[model samples]
Target: MKVLIIKTSSLGDIIHANSIISDLRRNHADAEIHWLVEESFSSLLNLFPIQKTIVSKFRSWKKNLFKKNSYSEFFQLKHLINKENYDFVIDLQGLIRTGIMCRSLNSFGFNKNSIKESFASYFYKNTIGVEKKIHAINRNRLLVAKSMNYEIDQNNISFSYNFKKDQTDPNSIVFISGTSNDQKKWPLEYWIKLAGLFERNNYKIFLPWGSVKEYEECLTIYDQTTNCEILEKMNIDQLAKKIASTRFAIGVDTGLTHLASSLDIPTIGIYTFSNPDLTGVKNTKTPAFNMGSLSNIPLPEEIFIKFNDLA
Candidate 1:
């Protein structure tokens, strides 16, 4: 069977969809699985054990709506998709853009969720209704299970990756402080204190930054710490390799946190404003913890204890 999965953009959501691929591959061992992802995030597909990956610059294409170049690229993507004649197309990122794509292909997707565009459900030839409050990973896996007519073991969730664990320092931990939203950032003062604790135990910290502002913040954190390194700017593949090899990780609500969890690393996700119940790291393969939620900020000491327990 030729299966096409449309899950483009947003690091966390793309990571959550990894479990869907696991379940799909398990149930249909002989099926050819293809993933369609945004051009920027196509690197995430590298570690996955899928057959084919189609990259689209939808985010950028959406901006230049009617330009000749944009239309040409758009049609080229359509032509590339139609050439496959996939037996099943699953739209994990339920959006109007993916919904419209379903018009030219038979697709399946999840039911309406809190933030999902309501009309997106109308396009799916087969829609799997799930609770809005479940973890995003479970919601995604359940949708694939329902569509494929297989049972999902909620307790046995796993994400299959082809990455080999590289050798990293024994006393090293990856500190993820970069987030798309400033509101979700864990306080730099708190991070400095956390680093102090790790330093006292002779542990080294690696901080990877993305934006200019985040790079500056990482520099400040590095300056105040004894054995901390501000990592060189890296792409998704390099970042993934680092996360997979690290001893432990603690990050704010970011896609890298989800990537760490998916890689089976002992990761603690710090939630300053988001709900952990709906978006926390769920890694049965490794010890994962979620601290704080909306209006409930976690203290430095509280996070320290959790980190200690994981270590």
Candidate 2:
């Protein structure tokens, strides 16, 4: 069967959605899976085993060149998607944008009536009920399970980070320092102090951030901290490979954090206003130190205690 998965924007959410591919491959080995992603994050799709990637520059409007080509790209994307004639399409993002994209799909089976989001039975020929109560990762997987008639076993989660022959640093500790919203970031001073702790313990800190704005953030800590390596101009898959090799990881509430923990990489997270239960892994030895407000994350010493406990 041919399937199109619509989960655009939000790095963390897209990474989480990847868990479904293994199930799809297991149950429907011959299924053709297509993914739609925001243009800037399209690089992530290259890492996954999938049929094709359809990207739109929804969030890339900030870049002048991307803004100029948005409409042309949209038309081109529409044409490309319609060509697929997918057997089934699922929109995990659940936003109106995704709804519109799903409606535009030129498919043979759907009842011509569109599914309206709030009134969205108007949009999908079939609408799967996905609640917001669960963590975003599980919720996305559940949506796929419901749509595809596959039973979800909590133990089943898959994300791979296979590195090149020489680049894997087995003794590294990856640090994810960027998140989509400012309110979700852990403080710089906290990172500085934490890096110092990691340095003293003989851990090599590896800082990987996507946005150029994060260069300064990583630079600030990188300059002050010893035994640290800051990765430059790296893509998501490259970052994932680096992260997969780490002995441990320290991350803010960012997509990379979820990626590391989901890969089961012995991760420790610094959560902001967001609930750790919603975004963190509890069963693993990883400690998600949540600071009720992003404005007030725990001190370096307290974080050290948790790190030591994990050790």
Candidate 3:
């Protein structure tokens, strides 16, 4: 059987979607699976256990509205998707653009009936609604399992990280200092406290910064902790590979934390505006501990306690 999964954008969501592929593969070992995601994230999905990837660069080309090549590229993608004539197409993205794209494809089955966004279901001939309360990883897995009429390993979390042995400071603990929303991050004072705690615990603290704002934060955190060292800008894919080599990791709601979790490293995820139940050390079959909300930040002791489990 041939299956096409349409899940686009957002580094973390794309990674979560990969578990569907993993589950499907286990159920149907001989099936051909294709993944569709945003162009910027195609490289990130390379680590996923899928065979093919279809990239949509619409987000990049939207900056130039007058660029004829942008719309032309969409049409070209439509042509490519139609040529595949996949037996099944699952639109996990559930957006207007993704829905329209799936409408152009030839699929025997389409999971759109119970999509989180109702409007997206209008484009498919076969739509299946899935349980929404489950965490996204399990939600997506169950959706694919429903379409295929198979069961999934509910205990599974989503990650694609491979462990690498590093020589420099095998006891390295990474501090991922980047997030999309300021509301989702812990305060500066909390970072200083956590950094001090890790330093006091005989661990080497490595601070990773993704943007200018995060870089500034990294400096502040590094200065506040004598054992902290800031890592300069690098691609997140490279960062994920490096994270898998770390002994421990700490981070906010940024893609770095998701990336760290993907690496399967025992990570302490600090959430402020978000809920760890939705997205935290995902894909970890092992137990997890998360710190969230503004009222209280996670102390190093609690995070270290989580370490005794996942580490």
Candidate 4:
């Protein structure tokens, strides 16, 4: 069977959907699986065992919709997708934009009531209903199982990846200090204090950033702490590899924190404004803890204690 999985954008949501690749591979051993993802995240797909990775420049196209180049690229993507002749096209992303992309294929997606944009359900050939309150990872897995007419071994959910850790430093820890939303960030003072605790214990702290604002925050933390080092700017693929080599990861609610947990590295997710029950890290190979919740931020000392317990 030839299957096409459409999970177009956003790093965290894509990471949640990625957990089901193992389920598809196990249930349909001979199936050839392909993934359609945003171009920015296309590099991260290399860690999965997929046959093809189709890139979509939706973010760019949206900004330059009237440009001739945008239309050319859009048609080029449509042609490539048509040529594949996929047996199943599943849209794990339940958005209006993603829904329209599935119009030409035999597609499956979330039912109206289960998705945020109910109208998107109208585009799918078959819509599967899943409980809205479950973890994002389980919701994606359950949707695929129901659509494919297979059973999921609840005891065996996996985040299987193709790459192995190049090196692991037991005394090294990663501090994911930046998130897309400012409200979700743990205070800078909290991060500095946390880094100091680890520094005194002789643990090497690695700080990574994606944007200029995040880089500045990381630099601030590096300057305040003795052992903190700011990592060079890297793409999703490069960052994932670096995270795999660390002993543990502590971060405010963000995609990289989810990526660390998925890689089987022990991860602690610090939530300041978001609720962990709805979208926290789950179904990983190692211990993954979600601390704090809406309006309740975790303290640096609390995280340090948790880290010590895990250590």
Global lDDT of each candidate? 0.86, 0.70, 0.72, 0.88
For model 4, the local distance difference test gives 0.88
lDDT of 2 at 16: 76
Q: RMSD, each candidate, Å?
A: 1.4, 4.3, 2.7, 1.4
Per-residue accuracy of model 4 over 1-311 as CA lDDT, tens digit each: 99999998789988888888889888889989999999999999988888999999989999999999998998888788878898998989898877877776889999999999999999898999999987888888898898888988755557867887878999999999899899999999999999888888899999999999999999899888889889998989999999999999998888999888888889899988887887886754678888998767889999999988866
Off by over 4 Å in 2: 60-72, 104-121, 160-170, 281-296
lDDT by residue for model 1 (186-253), tens: 89999999999888889988999888999999989988888899889999878999878889999998
* TM-score: model 2 vs. ground truth: 0.83
Model 3 Cα lDDT, one tens digit per residue, 1-311: 78888888787787677677667767899888888888877777666666788999868667866889878898899889988888888877877777878784543223445455677767775677676656777777776787778987788554432335355356788877667687877777777877676666678888887678888988888777798888766675676676767877778876777666656566678877776787765655533457765666666567666665667
Cα lDDT over the full model 3:
0.72
Q: Between candidates 1 and 3, which one is better according to lDDT?
A: 1
Q: Residue 269 of model 2: what lDDT?
A: 78
Pick the winner on lDDT between candidates 1 and 2.
Answer: 1
Q: Which segments of candidate 1 are over 4 A away from where they belong?
A: 112-115
Candidate 3: lDDT of 166?
Answer: 54
Number of the candidate with higher lDDT, 2 or 4: 4
